[model samples]
Target: MTTPQLLMIEDDQRLAQMVVEYLAQSGFAVTHAGDGAGGMAALERQLPDLVILDLMLPDADGLELCRRIRALPGAAGKVPVLMLTAKGDPMDRIIGLELGADDYLPKPFEPRELLARIRAVLRRRGEGGLAGGAEPARGLRFGSLEIDRDARTVTVAGQAAELTSYQFDLLVAMAERAGRVLTRDQIMEAVRGRELEAFDRSIDVHMGRIRAAIEADPKNPKRILTVRGVGYVFAKQQD
Candidate 1:
């Protein structure tokens, strides 16, 4: 079996070398790039199975690079990207997701956790020999929201709704299993490709952002309903 390839784009020399070594030990073939231009050059030649991109690149902005990657012909529907950022602000996280990143990880993180996240993203996209469980066939449509699995696009009232790759994945996970209660861990596993850490409060923040985009009243949140101490449920709409 061919080993999965990863592109590591970061300006931090020590961190980049450490991540490359760690990811190599984790069984992935990693190519390292020091700046955004180098990263883009490498991508233009051959896109990796996944990308580990640092937001604070020297040559160009990481978010802009992500957008460029998304715009690339073969990348629009393939090659998931995991953005790495040092900032932990909720808005920044949301913005990264909104910009088409598959997932975002705050820096000063454990290497093992990073590997887990990489595997999770690849698994969710049906790579790494992990078959996805059953999903809805006809696709899910609720009010102005339409999730087309085949196209991998979400449309709001016939117009494409701008969603980060992670948000889109989260929405699909809930929509397919509407009315089913999903725990925070389950949701994180499904969307971010990582289990929730103890005391991690970011999942709720992401969920709230998702609701604000999809629900008629984010304050009330009819679409994604909270289940008290458990998790959340995607309420099935009846016509």
Candidate 2:
């Protein structure tokens, strides 16, 4: 298997070098870009399998860069992005996901954790299957909401609904087990192959983003229903 190629778009040279070395050791071919513009130029040269984007950049905002990446033509637009945020703020991570980042790690993180996150994101990008081998067939339909597993696409009312790679997987996990109330732990484990972090609202944030894209009214979501203290469930009756 060819090593997965990755692009690191970060302005901090020292930190970027350290991450590059670590990821390279873990069998990734990494290309370093100093800033957003440099990152764009690198993309023009050759698009990597994944992108590690820093939230802060000299030339352009990370969120805007993420939007631009998603706007790129064809498969480039669907390339998975993992964001790095220096603030360690929940809102920052939330915003990153909302802007199309597949996953995020706050700055001053352990290299091992970053590696784990990267693997998880890549796994969701269909580099591999879930705990079980071989995914089900494509086209999971529910009223106006349609999920195409093969294409990794979602649409509501015949309109495409933009979702991060993570969000799409999470939605599939829930929708596959529709009518079942899944706790946060179950949802996290099923979708990410990991335990939920204590006090972490990452799942909630991603859920909100998914609802915004798929629900007719995000304020009052019907398909993905919340079970209050328990967790959430995808309604069996979509129509």
Candidate 3:
């Protein structure tokens, strides 16, 4: 089996070195870039399996860099991105996911947690094996909303909905279990093969993004219903 390659786009030299060593020890081949420009250059040379992007960079904004990365041609554009930010604001995490980041980790984090998040992102990308479970149906239809697992695409009312990879997965997770209410921890564990942390609203943010893509009225979502104090459930709609 080929080892996964990771590109770390961070300007903190000492921190970067420590991460590189730790991740390398954990069986990842990591490449370090000091800034967003350098990271882009490195990406041009060879697209890594996953990108560890730092929100703060000396040469460029991390959000813009993530946008550019997702705009790249071919598989490079589809590469999973795990964002690291010093800011502990929930809005930052939401914005990162909205910009196509597969996962977000606040700064001053433990290396073990970073490794776990990295593995989770890679698994969601279908690179770290099928740890989530058996493959879902090739196509799922609910009313006018269409989910094509084979193509990893979603369409609503015959119109293609633009969704990030993470959003798509979260939608499928709920859609697959239509009519069943799933707790936040249950959803996270099912989707990412992990548990949600205390006060972790990441799932809710991703749900909001998915609702915006598939729901007729995101503010009043009908497909994915919030179960208040429990979690959420995907409403089963008929054709």
Each prediction's RMSD over C-alphas, in Å, is 4.2, 2.1, 2.8
lDDT of 3 by residue, 150-197 (tens): 677788889978666667777778888899999987777666645535
Cα-based lDDT at residue 202, candidate 1? 53
| Model 1, global lDDT | 0.76
Weakest lDDT window of 10 consecutive positions for candidate 2: 191-200
Error of 1 at 173 (Å): 1.8
Residues 150-233 of candidate 1: C-alpha lDDT, one tens digit per residue: 666766668665554456667787776699998887776655455534323556766766776676678988778999999999
Model 2: per-residue lDDT, tens digit, 108-159?
A: 8899888888887788677322345666657789999998888888888888
Report every candidate's CA lDDT: 0.76, 0.83, 0.82
lDDT of 1 at 182: 88
Superposed model 1: Cα runs more than 4 Å off: 71-78, 86-95, 127-138, 143-145, 156-159, 180-186, 189-192, 196-201, 204-233
TM-score of each: 0.71, 0.90, 0.85
> TM-score: which is higher, 1 or 2?
2
Q: Which residue pairs show backbone clashes in model 2?
A: none
Q: How many backbone clashes does candidate 1 have?
A: 1
Which prediction has the highest lDDT against the true structure? 2
| RMSD in angstroms between candidate 2 and the native structure over all alpha carbons | 2.1
Error of 2 at 218 (Å): 1.5
